[model samples]
Target: MSRPDRTHFAPLLRVIHWTMALLVLAMLFIGVGMVSTTGPAYVSLLALHRPLGIAILLLALVRLAIRLGTGAPPLPDDLPKPQKLAAKGSHGLLYAAMIGMPLIGWAMLSAADDRVSLSPSLALPAIMPHDLMLYWWLRQAHTVIGVAFFLLILLHLAAALMHGLIRRDGVWQSMTFGKIPGKRD
Candidate 1:
């Protein structure tokens, strides 16, 4: 049976949402720091980044599956059509990046003949054939997409805050702890 309409997200979904949000933000910053520094710390961050990217890739798959199987709370009726479309479009893009970035990273490393080891003892097989030119292009694409993803995240945060603070709409509450202020069905 389909899930009953509800204001707040399913508890598990909420947990996943918050968890992925934190992880994604951490990955973004870690990526920047990894690229900018040169030292022991950089090496440590690089090690951390590999496994974290894999984790995000796996989690994104789970999140997408759950999202597709469940219904989300509807947007507030007062929100304009254009705003609604923008919200939907941005969310779609976020999901795309969430899934694409990790795969790109994995393939890039494979193309560069680098190991995809998660831990000292746990190694992953190559995802793509080795090609220096492909590696270079993927690296550039990853960087550009990372920046765009970061900006999109900022836009999402701004919209959430607008709903939570200025608009006083229940949009934020649907995903947050606050009560659902209207009918769910």
Candidate 2:
């Protein structure tokens, strides 16, 4: 038998989820775009990209705080223990990646002596001393971690689709549509 969708998510949670989704997707694409170019052409793009990444990092921090403070909707009674555990683990990994990726990116830029400014010609203080080896390592770290994040996203999407398709649940609804009331067991 099929199950029902619960108006599970709070409005704020939905907003945070989608906002982060858009920003993260942009970051993923821009990370690729940055490495794909050479010369001074995409230097400006990297400039924009770095600051925007930082902005996303800040926002992620805020979202993380809110998530910790508020309770998320619990899984339906029908969910098995292993599936529930997987859901919890996937979310934890997602949050860690969300926080870690941009931060490592920031550290990556900081290691390269890239002090970004909001506008052209303005300057900010560099956080770390510029070392070629450190910059190279951090760049590689950022690339590897970004790819991991992409993989995690695939798993996340698969689980969400599973809730909608196989489980006949509204896991997406909570985050997608406004909260649907949880079904009484």
Candidate 3:
């Protein structure tokens, strides 16, 4: 049977969205910890960072597929053209970073001849040949991209707040839980 049209995202998509949100936030902090220490704690942080990055990469692929197949709800009609363009551009950048970050990290490690070890018995094969120069370059690019990704996230949060609070538009509710303020189920 055909289901009723959804004003919000599909349940599965919402679940993945929130789950990835937490994971990504944890990753950012873990990344900072990994870079800031060189002691016993660094070992623990690296252990967490590698596996978590792979998980994010895999989940991002699944999320992108679901998004493409199901599509998102339209933006509010009153949203300005510039804001609409920004929304589209930002989402594209978000997905790009979600998918690209891990790949770059893996390649960076690969160029350094390091294994992407997920566990004592499991590890991913290197995708790039050992080249210290290349590894150094990728490492710098990764840090720059990571900072840009974080800034993009902040902008995204501000936009969401604008929609949910100042604008009182349904755009924010489209991806959120519960019934929209005035809309019936």
Candidate 4:
């Protein structure tokens, strides 16, 4: 058999990438809905957020391992230096937020002396000591990071559209459209 094409991400990585994308978006909206309302539905959204955050964290760890081990396709050589740097920095920030956000949320819950339920019946052990001040700080940091994470996602989407549409570059296909049959004319 021939070697798998390197232009596209490995299939597992692609699956995880899209899966986490949907999950993260849902989590963000659920968080907003949770804060914007009152009563039973709000409580349910809060419950869902914790488990979804954990799922994103677990998937991110696997995605990071695959990224490091297999590596991503290189950006086009014609790409400008500033845009390339922004691409790299944005990607790094995305990964940092993906990994950090859940852990911060987990720690915040722990510091608040709350049991971190992975499910209605399952719970995670506290990674941080119970401290009201720590909980307050972590809560604030989580909010700030969540906003930054959303902004980074918007930037990432804009860059992807630039590569796929305006630039007609294969960078987007490296993660998305997969390998094409022939080289660009």
Candidate 5:
């Protein structure tokens, strides 16, 4: 009923954060499932994967817009410059990966243009022609970019834990409970 505490994230931001987090995790699963399986299994999972990838692409764009318009809270004054730099680098990579992965996938599909059947009844059209060259290239790019994104996720988690448990700061609070610290004093 009331606004989120200043030290905390607004409800909208929290929804975006958690929703994005879950979507990213699902994307990872869909990706892994697609590769680990073949034939009918891969095809079925991929049907879900393709549409979801498109949706995530849209969501990421919206999230970025919101993030730009609403500046993130400032870092604790005591956080060292180097750590701050690392934080920035990691977050930037997260954003880049979010945008890059979907673009590459769409490009590859567009180039393939083959009727890649996600299921027996539902065939998802490829975005491109079936050029072996383009397919291989985008596939490689996707893999490499995905790895980078994976590592960034780990670093993001580590940073959150560090702030929540060790630093005892309100950084985690902002994202989780939707509040910041030091305001009560």
Candidate 6:
């Protein structure tokens, strides 16, 4: 595979980034809907949720591999040390959340002796033993992690806007479609 251009992400990475962004956003909303309702809509939301979570997990793994192989565009040279550290740390947390949340949800279901049905003819094997106490704890952890993930996303968005809008740095444009203004190479 071709390496990404110095000023922009690889095409595949950009595509997957946007796709997973939509998927993660939807998953968050579906999760909230699943927990906040008891009607038939809850069942529908769950059906959407299980498969989407698995999809996110799969995509995240692929994305991480690509990132490790290809790497990302460098941050602006003049960016402060603290901001640069925050950028790296936040990215690490986002990746962790991307990989962790679905696994936690799967394990939570497993502990409850529940099946994670991906389709009528397919399901995931349980990764945790059936234990009500464990299920309760896992469920709580899932909620907390979900909330944290949402906040992380907000922080990420803010940072991106700062790069694109306030700073007019190429950082945001690296992951996006347009050229990085004033960048020669």
What is the TM-score of each predicted model, taking all chains together?
0.94, 0.83, 0.94, 0.92, 0.84, 0.95
Looking at model 3, residue 179 earns an lDDT score of 69
In candidate 3, list every pair of residues with a backbone clash: none
As a whole number from 0 to 100, the lDDT of residue 12 in candidate 6 is 92
Error of 1 at 14 (Å): 0.9
| 1-185 per-residue lDDT for model 1 (tens digits) | 12346666666777888999999999999999989988777999998999999999999999888878776777877899999899989989999999999999999999999998988898889988999999999999999999999999999999999998888777888787767555442
**Best-fitting candidate, scored by lDDT:** 6
Model 6 per-residue lDDT tens digits across residues 1-185: 32345788777989999999999999999999889988999999999999999999999999999888888887888999999899999999999999999999999999999999999899999999999999999999999999999999999999999999999988889999998889775
lDDT of 1 at 78: 81
Clashes of each: 0, 4, 0, 0, 15, 0
Instruction: Between candidates 1 and 4, name the one with more favorable lDDT.
Output: 1
Better of 2 and 6 by TM-score: 6
What value of lDDT does candidate 4 attain over all alpha carbons? 0.85
Which parts of model 6 are misplaced by more than 4 Å? 1-5
Q: Across residues 1-185, which tens digit of lDDT does each residue of candidate 5 receive?
A: 11233465555767888898988888887787788866687977777877777778888898888777665766677999999888877888888888889888887776666554445687555666778899889988887887777778878998899999899787788777644556661
Estimate, for each residue in 1-185, the C-alpha lDDT of model 2 and write its tens digit: 11133245556767878888888888788778877889574776687777777778788888888776665766777889998888888888888888888777767677887766656776556666788798899889889889989988988988888877677665666677633435442
Question: How big is the RMSD of model 1?
Answer: 2.2
lDDT digits (tens) for residues 1-185 of candidate 3: 11236577777878898899889888988888789977898899999999999999999999998887777877777888999899999999999999999999999999999999999999999999999999999999899999898899889989998989988777788777866777776
True lDDT of residue 50, candidate 1 = 90
Model 2 deviation from native, Cα RMSD in Å: 4.4
State the displacement of the C-alpha of residue 122, model 6, in Å, after optimal TM-score superposition. 1.0
Every model: Cα RMSD to truth:
2.2, 4.4, 2.8, 3.4, 4.2, 2.2
Candidate 2 CA-lDDT value: 0.76
* lDDT ranking, high to low: 6, 1, 3, 4, 5, 2
lDDT to native, each model: 0.88, 0.76, 0.88, 0.85, 0.76, 0.92
Sequence-dependent TM-score of model 5: 0.84
Better structure of 2 and 4 per TM-score:
4
133-174: candidate 4 lDDT, tens digit per residue: 999999999999998888889889888988888887777777
